[model samples]
Target: MKMRFLAHFVALILFPCWFVSVRAEEIKSPQPCDFKALFNFGDSNSDTGCMASAFYPEILPYGETFFHEPVGRASDGRLIIDFIAQHLGFPFLSAYIDSIGTSYRHGANFAAGSSTIMRQNRTVFQGGTPFTFEIQVAQFNQFKNRTAKFFNQEKENSFTKDIPRPEDYAKAIYTFDIGQNDIAAVISQSGMEYSHAVISEIVDNFTSQVQYLHELGARTFWIHNTGPIGCLPVAMPVHNAKNQSLVAGYLDLNGCVNYQNDMAREFNKKLKNTVVKLRSHYPDASLIYVDMFSAKYELISNANKEGFVDPSKICCGYHENGHHVYCSNRAIINGKEIVPGSCDDPSKYISWDGVHYTEAANYWIANRIVNGSFSDPPLSIAQSCHA
Candidate 1:
């Protein structure tokens, strides 16, 4: 009887120690999951409706696939940013320009279609005025100031009211998907010879913009690099002659123009290096570089595996010779109103409107981004937001 009691006592003594160790480990590996907001900045890739609100004003065929009506998205469906917001358990972010009745409690999107990193007056494909990176940052600063004052007023009016604290800004995620338009502008206006210098300027401007945000109390950044522009149906027709002779030898296995993809790769490399430097410079910040190129490339390379019938062809665009002839909302043909057409099966096509990805492709990429293995430092959107 005495020996039995002693054995029980020994186990009791060790059990407390074991439990304490396990709990300490859990405490050390704190998985944060209470992110309250998401602030986004970028170009058409992430623009929900800023451009549409400003210029197009809910044009048809823009958001026909997903929203069933035009909601300002550049694609036939949702953009990658929309999926990210949905994955993070937040409603679609409202554009800063269209925040009249919207709640900013979950943050706002300052991105616009054709926005460039540099502070230049650039027109996007449809001649829409772009809100450059500088302009976006300025808008963000304005938002912060305005929100802070409003919160302060609310707190003063009612101490019992649950108001968002200033520290919440630090916990919010700031995402960027700009720089593509900048590269595209350079390629179209200045040719490939000046691309290196333009890309350098782009990186420098991007770094500066990040620094500005960091100064404004943003600690978490999710920056996306430029994607394969040359592969887009819009780009293929424009740059085909530049490398027509080498097309047979240089095109990707998926049939995308290699020269444009090469340019995208170079930009990604430099952006990656720039992100590394930013990490070192701001050791306390969570600066993540999202590899959008690889994500899109994977979808293109494994289209069949992903249940996509055509990765290169656009789901909604002008048709010519059994291929996409670029995307446009309307074209005047013989004085009649002819609109851009859509494929019967968008779910089976990767490209949407020749430039953006279909809703299916965006969902897949967003799933990969938030589920892990697509971001640098290897953190998913869920983990990043929660952290």
Candidate 2:
């Protein structure tokens, strides 16, 4: 396993150059940014293992595609965060909550599965994790302060390589990939009356959080807007067609609920505006807002062209008869025996389970956005630093 990881590490270091195209002018980075670390904040989309570590560990087939074992990720393999780490020539960011063997030299991830931007009126047992975006930020503050304290102590010298240097904080990449669950939760509970006020509040909370991170020394911001939730199989199952009458006329050709997509777009619009506002307020900060909706929607709408199969069909778990048995769980659904499973070809599928994307799909999205194709300033991830 060490040999395999070493090979990957060497490959990344050898091939670290990426071209940054600026308005028909292609500029090559002599080398990637001297980004010493990365501090991430988000939900399941970028979760390394926070939720699983704090809760139950994901079983086999969760990390089967890449790790050959469950490493507590909610996917079949690597996530966009993983690709981001690989691209930046850093080891994967360890979850802040997962203390076992976690080395945070490159930075720490505060994301957790099903985390929301604001506190919901439910428990972790209901759906999302208890750590809201605000809580994650608080955790980041604690991690930073505590690590600083440790560094000031003599006996903690052993953590020189496991913790970030004081100067590295300003050079770290702060990536955010949340808001999908918050919006989904709202729409699920409130139906078409999905409160824009709630969406506004979430966006405001997101902006505040980013500003806090910036104040904490994050200079380069890589923010991802919510994806097209309308296309998610988990959002609208075929068995629940009767319940989709509200979106019957709004359904796109590919069967995605356009109204839900519109809501996502609304959220993205507000988010983009907030980014613009932030950039204006903090000119020295590179706040890159990524259009994840277009990146994901394109893949889903044109899956065949991308060597992928059905866009809505999942690579893991079974959803039928208005019942869903998750990837690693088995149950008797509608008188049929359900077993834990996944598709034979995960690389050819868009979604992993009904909720999360497959590793292949994740890689595709990461590849596109990293090049600045979907970014606001059209700056590649390597050139995201304002410094």
Candidate 3:
């Protein structure tokens, strides 16, 4: 009788505390900045591991700096997208193609290296077929459908609770960092004379993709403009070689190929205008244009000031005669396997493999991009998340 009385006394004391805790939770409301997921699409600039997952025999020297091993990322370390995820308190996005023990609770990365905005069979530098932006969008739709069905099945089976609602996907942040490969392909195939026409076509395709994504419940958009491709070590040698007579006049004082930079600027202008149009059309949505050109140009123009000793020189490459040898883990040179050499300090260099930026450079650019100045709508990504 004494034991039962003691148990009743304890229950009476704890019951009110438990009820109050439950009531407090029930009264709490979700905050504006309480983002639940992130969805990304682009090329190598933001590809976490989509390329690696699609192709086997993962390349080395790609993720050596940050991950300590290759994880299919084009750079030596994390990309700007990775930094964004970290800033938002989320783990790195899992590549959609990664089928082995992957989680979709946070989000998926559909970005692939050498991916183009246009729907074409354009081959990447590594000879792998790219999954274009159109395909990525389709894949996202499929993912959504599959996830919804899974949630429904779980509900019917009484196996799980707290399934994501439709609004959750609509509220998720959608980021795009494509179009570099499209311009590069045009320049490589038909010279800079045809870039303006190609840029128009790319913009049309890009805007259409945004509309399609909006229809699929994406309300927030973060679009990245193409960076200065002409200043790349690989492109500089090619530009100088092709325009030998015009090199002296066209090259910048900093020795970067200026004509190519001019093309990039023109493309960025069009892209910015497109963003304005998108905002006008989708008044309810948050469409932000990230100024990648200015962010990158600042680094290039003030390399010394930014603590980078060599902004023009690539961190990893093979030394050759008046040409920048592309960085690769394994390459055949006269039937001999050759490995590219890397600098002792990659942080002091802007370009990593003649095309992609080093981790340090990406970090710097990401900081600028998220600090509100580089965004067109005059709001940082963090603020947009809150909005």
Candidate 4:
């Protein structure tokens, strides 16, 4: 009974077509400023080279577009965070595990391919192990420690007599992108059949994860609500399972699992409220919530405006059944094993591999974030991006 109630609630709340009007001007970009460094955290979507170098299935097609060879991104080229850093005048962050000294000084990326914003063993899907939000925060703590040591040594050598200044700390930027994996996990694993108590517990734990980041000097928060999960190649296959003999247009195509999507929306709503509640506790804190769902929807629904075709289909996949073998898989023949083909132009598609966005899509998202379209009224994206 509780499970059914939760499912009904999700269906009602997560449907994107039903939106309330919040009249406001489109947010604008802030006057550009320089930042010494950037740090990112999230799943494969935001991973630059962490997973590509760390994991298997290494192949040319991985980073073939931008690097003309694999550089460890889930996409064919750069990620949104990469663009954000470059836009701000800093070099792209090196992975935390990278051995290069100069890249390490620019900043470090803590993002892993399958990370989540929850502490539980909840996965992004059936067989994926995500570094929980708690784990990601831990990685940040490590980065902070390393940075302090590096800067501390620099100050000692340069100043030889004075204490470290606040300006030194201000030079670095810590950016984050997560929460989608959590919603995806709930949909794929629990499937809206869990008890309300279970759902509530999960939400509670998630809220705590955000609070943890706050305590750790995470001043600038770039939180993204889940995108249209239901519309993805994976979710589309699961949506409307009972509606057989139906045309493709007949499916409930709101982009995400209804209940889980609602969970994401409600999480965003409550998160905004939570941020308000937290301001008193952390006065200097700056938190910005990006409505990734709405942004992606506008891009996809009005593809012509963005000059894109189907945002639904990925650029690379198994020709058969569209079951979606790994994007970098070198061997995928006709229902067998052999080298496959990648699209000539990945930028034309929103999705690069089945599960991640193309460099083009990430660029568009970064533009919206800079433009302030995703920001709450009055505060603005520029204020938050630099906050």
lDDT of 4 by residue, 154-249 (tens): 444533222223343344555667766666666556555663444455456655766776666556665665677655655554322443464544
**lDDT for position 16 in model 2:** 47
What local distance difference test score does each model get? 0.77, 0.85, 0.79, 0.63
Query: Predictions ranked by lDDT, top down?
Result: 2, 3, 1, 4
Local lDDT at 266 for model 4: 62
Rank all candidate structures by their TM-score, best first, as comma-separated numbers: 2, 1, 3, 4
Off by over 4 Å in 2: 1-31, 122-127, 153-156, 191-194, 237-248
Error of 3 at 324 (Å): 5.0
Expressed as tens digits, the lDDT of each residue in 97-190 for candidate 1 is 8845555668789999878887775332334355988899999998788667766553454421223356688888899998887767766664
| Candidate 3 stretches greater than 4 Å from native | 1-32, 121-128, 154-165, 190-194, 238-246, 322-325, 330-337, 385-387
Model 3, 1-387: lDDT tens digits are: 999999878876879788678889996643445667889999989998887888763566778899988887888899999999998887888899887767667778999988888877533222334598989999999888867776555344332222335557887889999888777766566445656777787788888888999999888888899988877877665423553555356677666777777767877888889889888898888888888988888889899999997676778876444544566655666686667767898989898888899999999999988867888766778667532
Per-prediction TM-score to the true structure, in the order listed:
0.84, 0.88, 0.83, 0.77
* Candidate No. with top lDDT: 2
Worst 10 residues of 3 by lDDT: 154-163
What is the Å distance of residue 90 in model 1 from its true position? 1.1
Instruction: Provide the global lDDT of candidate 2 against the true structure.
Output: 0.85
Per-residue lDDT of candidate 2, residues 53-79 (tens digit):
898889988998999998878889999
- C-alpha positional error of residue 81 in candidate 1 after TM-score superposition, expressed in Å: 1.1
Candidate 1: 10-residue stretch with minimal lDDT: 154-163
Screening candidate 2 with a backbone cut-off below 3 angstroms (N, C-alpha, C), the clashing residue pairs are none
